[model samples]
Target: MEQNWDDLRLFLAVAREESLSGAGKLLRLDPATLGRRMARLEKSLQTVLFVKSPQGYALTEAGSDLMQRAERAEQAMRAATAGVPVQSDQLTGQIRVGAPDGAANYLLPQVCAAIAAENPGLDVQIVALPRVFNLSRREADMAIGVSAPTAGRLVVQKVTDYHLHLAAAESYLAQHPEVSAVTDLQGHRMVGYIPDMIFDRELDYLADLGVGRVALASNSVSVQVRMIQQGGGIGVAHDFSLAATPGVRRILTDAVSLKRAFYLIRHADDRRNARLAAFAEALAVGLRAETARLEAATAGQAAPKA
Candidate 1:
């Protein structure tokens, strides 16, 4: 019995998703049917590919080895079709990108919208979550991260560097003590990421300000910005985000400034995929332009009168 390409495709999906239901969802097959097909594949190979457990499917050692080869085969198949004629700008496939809520909510919507407008056939799905995504598990085809990852067979491209500063709503600034220096932040109520839920060290914005706690905290960036907008308190906020948000103004521009960069991450194998490469370039270019365009608003808004 020989291994079939379609069977290998299904096997790869199961290995990545780690469960019948997860793989079924991605492949659009019922769990029972997927299980039956997996059983058939195992029978042909005369090996147990997965061990069932409470956590779902755990790939056997043999299965892990097979996964590597299957991935190579998948890449080869994609490369084979690279020479086929297609519209240069029109891409037709689903690409899922995961990012922390800040960029996902504020930046990506505009960047992706523009790409989709140009490539009408491209289906872009954005997953906004506070924590880092597991790219190896196929949680997303690509991810945007605040920091570059050190481990994983992944390709990382630094997208852009942006700035952040302590900010608060005009109404809050009016009622609170003036923030002329970092020392002034001591008595003010602060709103920022939940102390423990800060996903990346770079996101520990408040702590960098020498503050340890938040008067009001949420894991979501959009929520923190809303808290600032509602005059909750001063928080370190992205200048790009503050531009889109009304009523929020930056404070202590010279004293409490922060710089951060965004990185675009993809599987090591995806470098061979032409479509993904093109999409990645477009996204990176769009982000650089968008960040510059939005940060311009920061130039016009006067720092609060101290």
Candidate 2:
């Protein structure tokens, strides 16, 4: 027999609430309207689904049995709807990803290229935000964030540790001769990420260095890197950002080593979605490879000069 899903939803709400008024409030319908809909549903089914009493409404035997079946039907319907679009081993849907500006600049391009190469049908959209995106509301299919999310419903994987160091433009270093001590930072015009936008430890580090005032401040890591390249000022950046940039040079100091982990996060519910899974896997692999390359580059720079 054909059944209306809306009626089933109303029935489930009434059954769970055990009161017509309560269910109406839950569904945002007037009590009279809810009563009329329930009556019509009972007439269509030709059964007394609820017993009205002074206390409230209670589900009858038929209604209880129907409630159980309806709940299962709803679960099955949701699963079926989600599963239909995804074919096994065939990735083909758009995956929206949220990432920080630095990661987007230094890492995401290669990952997107790899995903596109592996699954031509998959579409990837990257949104670079300085703050975290809400995954519970499906703001993004996946997120690469600096902090490990404490939300229980999210599946988080620690992708890799990003190494940060101080960098200065070659021209700036040429102008101000390298002093072999950390205290020498006092004389340099320092550029930095905006205080509120920077991660906590990095901000604290800057504070501790007595460089309380910024020569230049920016929210975007790419912008910060560019400003440093143009000899705007000295700033902290991930090793990868300065690797290929011609005018930037790393400032080697023992106090400058900072590392933060990158986390791959997605809702637990969407973890099984084929497109999201494929993209996440490809992204993780690509990021790890990039991290290794950056490490090797850093090591080479640290090597003794012949």
Candidate 3:
């Protein structure tokens, strides 16, 4: 019996994600279906491809060998279509973008909207969850991230620097004793990332405030912003994200401003992809403008009308 070439695609995704659920999220397939397909693929090949364990799927020797050939085939497929000329006006297909919750909540919706407007055929899917985007698994076509990747066949570019500061709702500040300095933070309730759940070092804002713990904590930045909005407690917020919230007030602005840069990342294999390249260029332009807006907003100024 001949093997199904399409199974190779599923195999590759499982190999990269090391779990059916992760691959299913990217592929939009149910886990049971993925498992059945993997089983069928394995049977057709007359060899076991993976060893399933609680941690996830581990590739067997045959699977490892197949992965090498599958990669070569993937590269060839990319090369075959690499020369297809796609003008800016003719761009189409979905582009998944991954980013931290802060960026996703405040910046990407507008940026992606502009991209979609320019290319009506393009579909932009923004993955807002704050986790490492596995581009190798097609988890996202491109990603905006707080940290530049130190390894992987990825192309990374610094987008722009933005600011963060301890902030609180006006009501919260009015009720709590005024925070006059960093040390004063210890005397009041604080909302921040759960100390142990922080996946990236850049996200450890409580430590920046010299606090050992938070009165309330969440892994999501959007949740932190919401808690602050509800007067739950003072917390670190992105200047742009907090810009539109009327009641939020920057605390210790002069004494505690932290600057961070966002990086644009894409798989090296897709570097020449016309739609991806055009979308990235548009995203960069939009991000730069947003960065300026965030800077002005943080300094108590309004961004000039575009």
Candidate 4:
């Protein structure tokens, strides 16, 4: 049987993502279509490519062997296209950005909107996930991460630093006993990230702030913010996000605060794409302006208590 390069490409996407939905997300194909393509590819090759379980797609021995060949082909294709001239002034196609919920909710929309306004032909997809993006797997075109990638064929640049603090709704504070010190935190209900589901160490805000557990928990920072807004419990919030939400007031502001940085990450092979370069520059500019406001909020200037 003749080899199908397109089938191999689909195989590679599934291999990289380890799940049909994940690969479909990258390829912009339906999960069922990806599954059928994989099935056809397996039939043509006369070997089992994957072992599907609830956990996700896992490669078989045959699939693992094919992966090496596929990766080599991918590299060659990238090299062949590297020299092709791209229009620097016109941006088109999709750029997917993966980021943690805090930055995704508070920062990326405005930046992406401004970029889209300038290039009507461009589309931006923001995956506001609470996990680190794996650049080696082509999980996203660009990613905003809490920490820079230390090892990979990647380029990392510091976007900005922002602050976080323990906060509660003013109504909740008024009704509950005063939280005058760190020890008082233990006596109150807390809203926080699910302890075991936290993908990054930086998100373990409760432990860092001396609280051992939360009364309410979720995997999303946006959910935590909403929980705090509803007077569910005291929780950690980014100064930037909390600044815009009314009725939330910082607690133990002088005693408990955290500073974290964001990084712009891109695969080294994509470093020279003009559209990517332009978008990255715009992202940096937007982050700078937003972080300035975030800094001011930390200084007790942005959102005043009602």
Best by TM-score: 1
Q: How would you encode candidate 3's per-residue C-alpha lDDT over 1-306 as one tens digit per residue?
A: 544557778888888898999888868899889999999888888999999999999999999998998887887778778778755565688888999888998888888887789788888899998788878778788999899998999999999999898889888987889788899988888899988889889888788668986989998999999999999998998888877777887878888988899999999998877667878888999998987886687568442232
128 Cα displacement, candidate 1 (Å): 1.2
Give the candidates in order of TM-score, highest first: 1, 3, 4, 2
Better structure of 3 and 4 per lDDT: 4
lDDT of 1: 0.89
Q: Tell me the TM-score of each prediction against the true structure.
A: 0.93, 0.70, 0.90, 0.85
Q: After superposition, how far is residue 172 of candidate 4 from its true place, in Å?
A: 1.4
- The regions of model 1 sitting more than 4 angstroms off are 302-306
Candidate 2 — which pairs collide?
A: none
The models' CA-based lDDT, in order, is: 0.89, 0.78, 0.85, 0.86
Instruction: Please provide, for model 2 over 195-306, each residue's C-alpha lDDT reduced to its tens digit, 9 standing for 90 to 100.
Output: 7777535334467667778878887888988999999878887887767676677776476788888999987766555556767888899999987797667656743232
Question: Residue 221 CA error for candidate 3 (Å)?
Answer: 1.1
Q: Cα lDDT for residue 144, model 2?
A: 90
Task: Point out where model 4 deviates above 4 Å.
Answer: 1-5, 19-22, 30-62, 297-306
The pairs that clash in candidate 3 are none
lDDT of 1 by residue, 94-209 (tens): 99999999899888999999999998888999999999998877788899999999999999999999999888999998898778899888899999999888789999888777
Lowest lDDT sum, 10 consecutive residues, model 1, at 297-306
Candidate 3, after superposition: displacement of residue 44 in Å? 4.0
The candidate scoring highest on lDDT is 1
- Cα RMSD of all models vs. native, in order, equals 1.9, 9.6, 3.6, 3.0
Model 4 C-alpha lDDT per residue in residues 1-306, reported as the tens digit of each score: 556678778999999999999999888999999999999888888999899999999999999999988887777776676567876576788888999988899888877898889889999999888998888898888899988778989999998888888999987898899998999988899999999999878778888878887899999998999999999989998888876778887888889978889999998977766667878888888887977876586566455434
